[model samples]
Target: MSDSIDSPIIIDLPYEEGGKKYDEDIFARALQTETHQKTGQVESSNVTEYHLRILLHYPAVYVIHAEESHSQRSEPEYCVYVGETNDISQRTYEHLYNDPQNRDDWRLFNNHGNMSQYVITHPYFNKSLTLDIENQLMLYMSSVDHVSLPVNKRVNPQRDYYTHDRFKRIFSDIWLDLHRKNPSLFPAEGIILDSALFKASPFHKLSDEQLEAENIILSEIFAALHLESPDQIATDKTNPADSHLILVQGAAGTGKTVLLSHLFYRLLTQTLPEEDAPLIHSPASAWKSDDKHQDGDHASQRNLIPKEDISAYILVNHDEQIHVYNQIATKLGLQNRSGTVVLKPTEFLNRHSRKNDRHRALLNEPIDKADVLLVDEAHLLLTQGNRAYSGKSQLFDLLNRAKVVVAVFDPNQILQSSQRLSPKIQKLLSPADDSAANPSNNGNDDEPSRIQLDDYNNAKPLTVDVSHIRLQQQFRIDASPEVIAWLDAFTDEGIIGELPADCHEHAWHADDSVDTRSKPYDIRVFDSPVDLFDAIKKKAEIKADGCDGKGLSRLLATYDWEYTSKHKNANDPSGHWNVELHQDGTGTWRMGLGGGDGTDNTSHDRCFCQPWNYQLTDPHSHRKGLNKDQAWAEKPYTINEVGSTYTIQGFDLNYAGVIIGPSVQYQDGKVMFHPENSKNKNATNSRKDLGDFAEENLKDELNVLLKRGVHGLYLFAVNPQLQQRLMDVYEASKND
Candidate 1:
């Protein structure tokens, strides 16, 4: 054949002619046939040049074409729909079997369903490509259907109803109904609606009447439930008359904190005196009000009310969260001797001194008069201890006394076995009782029953009986419609959308040495602790350079090292890392404070140590010399603080490098195989037992280490075996 003839001829065939010539058989054969180039599949007769262009440019697109013949006496036997998908097989299954969400469309073609034929075009063949293909396919199909209408004819009323705006409005209405009637069925406590569905709906622009109606309806709903309106709950307002416990649940970035702040403001300002009166009735009075104490001075002096009048807003969490909140409060001028009280369980206990028994007794008295109690991380508050002595009753007692309490919880981040509470708590927070325990239970009566509140005889229960509200809007990023849709799909499908659009451009430049230029999204992984140490040193260097060698402020180095303790041979080389010392050799590790004299004579052992002067080794003691006692052994194991990841959770740093020591592993489908295990296995055997003793330690280690970074995270697993385990977790989480 001539070169000109060999080149496939491009034709602008009519839809009918194209359909007749390229049936299912021809299309299938073409897809399977070997092409001349051996790289590309043979061109199918059913696919058009337009579709081919789309496929070639956008490898994620799938093109489907069909034709049907209509008899004058009956309806058409076939209807075609074009769509793209990451998984062709799944999309095909849904269209052919699983009815599309819009039942009206399905009903229109139900009579001719048997005559329908389906063809799928695969974009990518990798396992990861499945979801992407399916998503793209859905988008393409919807888009094609949108533009396929006859231009000259009047628009279909049904089509108008399915418009992006209309879809969003309908979905919003459905969500509102579901949220009102069956609130607990939705995840994230229904605070998160389908962003895509919302965009497709027509409810975004509420008319003045609609807005007023919505507010009134919402107010009535809250009123009927004897709960504060969502607006009132979010604003910083206090209802001295109504003592109801409010549960505000939602994912991050849903204005929870902002709403809480507003509520605080309302609570603070609403109680101001209505008017200020002068001491004297008139100017003619010879003896006027004490002019020395002018209104301006009075106003200035009385700007802040007495601590007793202010509602006690308590934010509870583990030690770390409390520490972070304290720091934030201090910076925001919200902290005062009585206005803000920061207390850990140990700190609360320590306040009871043996010498000041009377003060200690008063300190432990019930907080029955507290006006308001806000628990920021309520999930962390529920965790139990091994014994009653270490239990959280102190915190529980305080919570029970408050007139109003607000809490936030994320079920997915449950960190401890004890943290998991009874269904009673879940029921109280959930909007409805149906499916509150398990939506997948199929209403099985034979299933094990839940423990009733009455079962706990010794303890007085803390009941949160008020109505619930869920915040659905996310204001974290300025995302495009496409990006929002993609995120929504990921959340719906239970897939981890790594490199989400918010973090898309967060990579660091390979040549950029300055830490200031580094992005937060960069994934930094190292095989050894030395590498992590080097990364930290680099950041320190950048800080030093930025400060013109004046030395960085608030920069500290903390490690799991014991030689740095205050009680250790003060003469030992690494004795500057400890924060406190008791008569015993044990001491606490100070997370911040390092850099000191080369001889290590600093009063505060935890003072900052220069990088060049610091050494990761123990030196032989001289006077009162190296105590050979096992407790005082100068061995490496005794020198470093082992497994202290919990000390730094809920904290942020300019940069952080986590070094995964060798004493960790994953074996026999369980995370174990550690030397510590061999010595501690006798402690417990049950999953809960092991989890209580080990899992929290490991998770705390990871959580604290991960959270330390404000701009960057550098992870280094010292052991290759442990590195692999960490990698497996990262990969598995990504897949999820």
Candidate 2:
């Protein structure tokens, strides 16, 4: 193994060769066992010096799976396992002979005849790099539709390494090779990358900002909980606050969900950094770069971690996103062990909060406490009572129960009045700034702005030390800075400005269509809703770069059309709640196409209409098998339907076809929000005591709709004024 050998070596183990698990001499033995190339005679040989030299002799990572020949599946599915080892030969022998005596999972590979393994070895593979690769494989394989269940659960996601920069390219090359060998077992990297579980997996490497945030947050948690600290970490100073609330404020697609997922996994799997700790007990992943060995073999040193009972949970409000987080929890063996790690805000409230709790627990009073509570989409937390949750405020209730509440918050994403943060609380989450630019508290990535609130939500009073941390980078909407500025201007300032001269823009004509020709992004505006839908269908059929199958494209809209999770009435027995729009013969804008004057949006009209999401049946539904819950955009059937903020919040689309409904209109000077035109009671409903947030809520609705596309954004406005304004902007940009 040498640095010159940059490419990964993929070795496939045959099912069996005379009761042996692997063909160490694969190329030579295959030619001998089946037919000699020179002699046309059947023979076998188990000797090859060249194959032996590279056959898992060095450090490597490996994956093995079993496929039943008589299994009742349209496509192949397998029970997969991913592992890493320094001595691959010994590890293989142990799995086949010894490990089966203790573990049932290994027994499958031991006895099953249809088992095959693709061993991955590289010259740069070391203890930490191989472990990280193994963890990534576990995460990716578990999310694959073809993988039924996983046998290996050792999730060791390493921190920065000497060759960490090369990990992404190396792992991709290895995966591509494996896919070529068994396309069914190993789906294309694109399909896996687009999955919700993969997006939320803990194995995702952190950006510099994310890494800084992670370290600071972890330090905060340790300080708050008074956990044992190593010598290098400062722990002499202690804050006497009863509870700590860390507010992670960022716009959409700033890696908030992934950051929370990674933290949750760390809280469950890790202890604290120590010297000479074994694999599962060490925080060596977070070791400093200065501590690395001169030869880049720092992993050889064993640093153990102290074990602690750090009860942690991550709560989200959405129905589909909960499924993604829960699936990640299950695959990594983080749930159903001691207690659940992923939960809804309401379920957690009921389970943790005492029914008799009317006042907050007094200082130093006996209170039920959890180590850490991570809240994703904290803006979606209920600010008022509902039938489902009787609490006055979900955020306040969570703070009363947990030692530290780390919530991913963005006031702009607060969709409904029930989830809106009042002016009083606004001061606490205010002044969101880039952590990278304004580092505070001894020059770490923590925000300089901090507010100490003594009493929060009088109904459940508690002392909370609130801090705001902002993530400014845009991870979604793969467009230029000018493109992002244009979108922000429209949503935040209500101005549709011209695009940049070099903006990554594309328009589809009969001759020009979507393809995977390595474009940075594609932004287009359609005058007709039908044309937008057609282009979306075309984009869905075309794969993006590094993908093997069709891309993910969905029709989205503002909350203008009427829709519900239930059936409308006996007249519409099909329960196909649709977003219908058309012209009233004079080409005047008309909604709900067929029932004459277009007053009722749910009229029985099929023309110029498509069902809202969760309304249509996709012939390819069986192939997707959405596990009874999926992100609205992830399903194949949803392409025939339209989605809104509820189903698509905290999600991304490869290409988004957003129908900007009439509720969002361009008025005298700028974008005007008309709640009267909206059918969403949540957005238009009168706030009981919290002031009117309709304008802000609808503004967020439009902002969210416009930002869903990662590779592209396709838009059409139902409002004539808004439509005309957008066309004007598009035309003005053409000259540049």
Candidate 3:
């Protein structure tokens, strides 16, 4: 896991003894006994048969090795082949030598007649499990320095774990046996553990409850899928009508994203290792054509469902989110998998819509298809697709087409007018009749509506009732209960009171009298933005020098800035910021201006304008380039000022320097918002009419900005009155 380019090679995989005793294992006997006992029990026989056949084949993982010298290193390296085969003798023969008819078919070894082979076999292995082992082996081999990469191209496998303890023990034994068989090649402590990867993986890191939620969702999808039969589908030539909609409701920091990541992986790959067993009978193996045409054709004529019968896609709305998702997909190897695409919602809609002429030709025929669709930040689904989607609402369109739709919904996160759900969808989400599904209990105003059983059951054949799951636990902020309670009250009522009695003592507190050094969370109220900027810089430098545990900090602010409608060419004699601070006293400062003339830009000293976070127009070439976010992440500094909701949403920071702009102010003992003062047309336009959507979104944005800081939240306000009000609220909450 270390970021070492040339670490010494350390292998601990021993050669052979105690490796292939799979036939005698208790797991093998238990599977046989269970399969026989369940012969007449049709309800459980399918699952039992799956386990029985997997244990019977007794799969083996083998390695083919050949020594070679490369120019990159002084020492010779080995081109090692690691694979699993049910028939090791035949498979190895084919790999080392050639077929009687086609010599190229056996060219895996290439001119290297001299080779050594090693193997570890197990009785209870499936396609999913074998792929997992091969992937881990590749990762380990790739980690070694001066070692030629493994000859196999591993397909990243989902960590489809066994639910049975016996099966778990069998897999563990195989792993240990392999290490013992080749100690010089497989290091004992070298490769990272799957559990470790699960923790660090963007797709994992969920609580037990969240894991349960994932299982429930999968079970529901499986239930719907089970309703379709191959014979029926082939005859009807119609997409199945058993789709279901699952609504996941959670607020900003409630780990909806983490859940979505887990869902994306689990859905695309098999979830349980034993679920798809009997490799010989699997549709994939059956479909492999060879010179034994009759034999291959006979094998392929089975009633098994192809893996592609179900497909999963993870969809977002923004390009930045797509970039982040694509990176994660590549890391997890999901990017290589067929039927799994991570893209923006618009792209997804366009690809699936029949309206796109190019798509019809590319895909052979236009048909709306997707077994499962996971929509992250569902609140961001556009009510209008900007004419690209032919004006269809993304949510309803997806629900109608996909068999299983899972959405992470947060009403407060809807910042644009285009993202509003229709009235019918809204009613389904939040029924005006259900009292229990009210705002007070769920922490969000809109909750999924309670559907009467008859409503869906009596409706059209394909219609589905929406199921809602609300997640309440907060994971992003490490604050006391009182602090969270205070934040909630502040957002809800624009004020705060004495700290709640149940609140625990933590790093966060706001009394000026308290010792600042003792509190990890330094809640500060600064009158001047310049001083706040200096303090954030000092912290960043300390962090950069390895003095602070909580990593990098960044500056953030309210969208009281006008994102200029006038497009300025990067070559324009005068460079202008797409986002200009629209406050009365604020001056226009362009990013990358470089202290020009040092006159009108006192603001430059306080803001380190980073153009990478937002798109920039190159004036000289009239081209758009230089992603500020990519650049800033590589070389982060507190002074590299850049952040807006678009860039910072769904991301976490160590400390946040917040500047409350003039758009929001303290007036007549209440917080007031002036949309005219804000140039963010989206926020301003989103506020007009229609209840508290705008108000809630604005508060949510600030709440998100404030809670981003893991260790501290530094504050500055354009309006002095609002600054004093916040300080007063913080102080009142800390009083005994």
Candidate 1 stretches with Cα past 4 Å from truth are 1-266, 269-310, 317-367, 382-395, 410-459, 466-520, 540-572, 576-647, 662-693, 707-710, 724-736
**Model 1 scores what on Cα lDDT?**
0.34
True lDDT of residue 452, candidate 3: 27
TM-score attained by model 2: 0.81
Ranking by TM-score: 2, 3, 1
Question: What C-alpha RMSD separates each model from the true structure?
Answer: 26.5, 6.7, 14.0
User: What TM-score should be assigned to candidate 1?
Assistant: 0.39
- Tally clashes: model 1: 40
* Per-model lDDT: 0.34, 0.69, 0.53
Per residue, candidate 3 scores C-alpha lDDT tens digits across 1-736 of 1211111111222222232433324333444443344343332555434443443344656666666655644445566666666654445445543342354423544555445665444443555555455544554443333233323433233333552223333343444545554554543422322112221233233465565566556555654565454655676653445456778877667777877876675455433222232333221232221223111132334444544556788988755556556545643446653224887776775577554445431212225678889988888887654545544356656665577788888877776766776565577566344443322343222322234222221223235546667777767655666666666665567664544433356432232232322243456766456667678777665432111134466777777654454675464344544233221223432222334545443454444433323444333232232222232222343245556777666656656788777767788887777666665666656423243345556766676667666566788776767877777755664674
- Per-residue CA lDDT of candidate 1, range 124-224, in tens? 22222322333322222222211111100100011112123222222233233323432322212111221112111111233232222223222322232
Residue 86 lDDT (model 2): 75
Clashes of 3: 18
TM-score of each: 0.39, 0.81, 0.60
lDDT of 3: 0.53
State the displacement of the C-alpha of residue 468, model 2, in Å, after optimal TM-score superposition. 3.1
